[model samples]
Target: MKGMASYSSSHGRLAMAGNLALFCLILELASVGLAHADELRVGYYSSSCPSVEDVVRNTVTNAVARDPGMPAALIRLHFHDCFVRGCDASVLLDSTPGNPAEKDSPTNNPSLNGFDVIDEAKSTLESQCPQVVSCADIVAFAARESVRIAGGFYYPVPAGRRDGLVSKESEVNQNLPMAFFNVKQLEDNFARKGFSLEDMVTLSGAHTIGDSHCSAFSNRLYNFKNTTNASDPSMDQTYVSDLKSKCPAPGSGQDPTVSLDPVTPRTLDNQYYVNVKSHRGLLSSDQALMNRADTARMVLANINSGSMWLHKFADAMVRMGKIEVLTGTQGQIRKSCRIIN
Candidate 1:
């Protein structure tokens, strides 16, 4: 009888253990499901029922089609915001009227003035989609639209990001890649954000669609005269003459600039690679990719073949959008899309 009791006690303990393990498994699944539900909530507000991404893309494309000149400014704004804090839509705020140093101040970037675009897009999206979508998703979708309008292809954009309340002009100054960056500086900046050298080259294909303000690279065009130290032999004489006509001096407060793709200035095509191959790239940083042995092969491959460039560009954009994404309370829903608070 004692032996029977012992066996029964052991069986009861084992049954309890199995029940506990099953309960734990159910709890784990619930936690995961709750996390995913939170992500979806963070993506869209409860009041509205439309996809903000759709609204943003449509609005931006329409805006650009109405004013083709807006694509360059839009691209600049997108890059400035993304490079600063992972594209949180902080850069789209118009927080300060007079203080140009404020991160959310449109005055800081008089040339781009992204708030105007954001305002128009928001007003339209609100009218169409109502209160259903978040501004953070709008910004991401707008970035992709801006890039596409500038003559690039689309990549998968993972949605559900929230806007950040803070914008830092200083951060923009610190993070933006200069026209004079060597291959190493470019590689390091990209590497910090989990991108490889190949990704750097592929993403730089954005140069194919926009124009650089001569002010941004006067040092390369007018100041770099010494043949041994600062010469850029790749510049086209006609293009340089045109630039000089617009911007006569290095500090002349001029906007003289060259197109990344002189042939197809408005199309997002492989022309940027072709320009690099011919040594007509506008920025030293762009030309450097062609000069470096490490990245030169990739540059040549893209320039020599169209399909290869498109495939890599698409892949790199996907990789870029995935960098350090903010999901699960990493950020907040901005009542105002522009300001972090």
Candidate 2:
């Protein structure tokens, strides 16, 4: 009987040991999860710039105040990066040791490293935040800032994005929607990434602040017959004539320049819609929205009133942040925001 009691006592002690071990394992897991959550929150908050957008807005407002001739180059840079890959800073990194002149010179057509603005902004943020913010979030913040600087609305930006570790020129060529795409082509491209027709129109509102080179959309202006001219009848004659005067001959790829938004050419207002309403859209894709009965009405409604358009634009941007993003172990934390292997 004593022997039996001894065995039972030993079993009891073993069971108690197992429970304690299980409890300790659970506690350790909880601690790790809490740490991870904290890290994610840090990443999210660092990306937002509560005061940065206002600073950018003031810069653009001051530029216009001083000189209306201030080029929309900065606005163009912001739009180009955001549209291609959901505003990842991959567009700004000069990972390769190429010529610095080639990097900054807008005249260098084949290779344009226009990420100087991105670098400057990142440097500024790093000085203040230091390894807390992600470049992806910074791009979004900068876009709104650029708009505000150009006298546009201050759209709400959602944070919590990480910098991408890869930037493929080939990918940009494939993914970035061209200025010459037809309405259907543009629709398919945006839809592939889960954007609706309304989203497309509102996002294109970005044109309100940027300028495009003749080379970018010369196909539409000069070679209308060779490309999608069926929808060409919808464009504003005055605007098209202006484009023709600038582009003149096909394949010239020279001398033409067009503002995405003619009315508020340098401002980030709802004027792109106003342009479309007046049939003054610069691109076939822009006019295509109005050419269609359904999209045209929506454009008219949104343009006439600013509140709805702003809300939709903000929502679409938030949805964009949730795309097939690379985070955690999927992508590396790129030391340099611009270049990636």
Candidate 3:
């Protein structure tokens, strides 16, 4: 059998030979496939969804104006969507009577917001272009808009992703990096998505403007070790005292939230790394960056060099938006983002 391949900057100019049997086998084994770099390009919607950028920008801008936290929420929404089902917008699926979707997963549930914003964008697109736009692309675009609105670096988002059909609750935990993940676990989780250690640390900077529920980090604040009444030793005592007030006690309130970077909670800057350097990273996973020599180096470098960090982060986000995307008839563009057609 003969197989053809092409090169593109985003996909690193990959070419395959032989029957292409090996490639298919690998994708099947991993349960995910990389998007053909040529399939998605910077101006993919120039003709199809010409107004996509304006529509998304206006929608996100208005939403952010009403609630400043919306940008961070949109950014995290994109992350959760890509992590679960390969940037297919599966995270937007609503739970049906018999089949609970990713949105209902405990890992996601109340923590992941911005669904209404996405739904609104999809609705506007449908009104203008009908089925021309994909929920997956809207998500990627919204994330870029979110960062730009948050005073962070801006980068182009390649388009042409299609909405995925599957959204199982069970798959969420298997793919997402957990709040309690140790350094190795953190590295492994991102590695599965074809991300590097640097990508993990740089992308983790998104925590700069977001907040976490008390339950996400309550374990670190109380009975951290196996011993009773023990707290995580790596955390600063003063920070722990502040967290304790917000969190109160274990099982007290799961929904009360605290900023990931209390110093600059509303800004997307190097303060997140600065907090990690000070032993003030909110989640165990955030603190875990300091535990590894390699990640620790990245954390400090990001702190000392703001411009470099912003550039690396923008590059990383672009790479992330390409994960296992569907194109050229691989998946469908749903009329409504919350349900499969």
Q: Output the number of the TM-score-best candidate.
A: 3
Clashing pairs in 1: 48-132, 151-268, 164-340, 165-340, 165-341
**Among all candidates shown, the one with the greatest lDDT:** 3
Stretches > 4 Å off in candidate 2: 1-43, 46-87, 95-114, 226-232, 251-253, 328-332
Query: What's the TM-score of every candidate structure?
Result: 0.76, 0.69, 0.90
- What does candidate 3's lDDT look like per residue over 100-158, in tens digits? 99999998888889999989998999999999999999999999999898855688998
Comparing 2 with 3 on TM-score, the higher-scoring candidate is 3
| Stretches of candidate 3 exceeding 4 Å from the true structure | 1-24, 27-35
lDDT over C-alpha atoms for residue 277 of model 1 = 72
In model 1, which regions exceed 4 Å deviation?
1-48, 95-108, 127-132, 147-152, 225-231
Model 2 lDDT tens row, 103-196? 2333324333234554555566566556655666555565555544564455566555566654445455455556667677878888866678
Clashing pairs in 2: 57-148, 57-149, 60-149, 93-338
lDDT tens digits by residue: candidate 1, 1-341? 99999999999999999999999998896676445334543234334545566667777878887877566666666666666676566666655654333343332455554566677667766676654345656665676777676655666565666566666565665666667888999999888666788888888887877666667655555647654334345777666665566655654555655566678887767788777777777788988887788798888888788767777776665455444445556667555565545
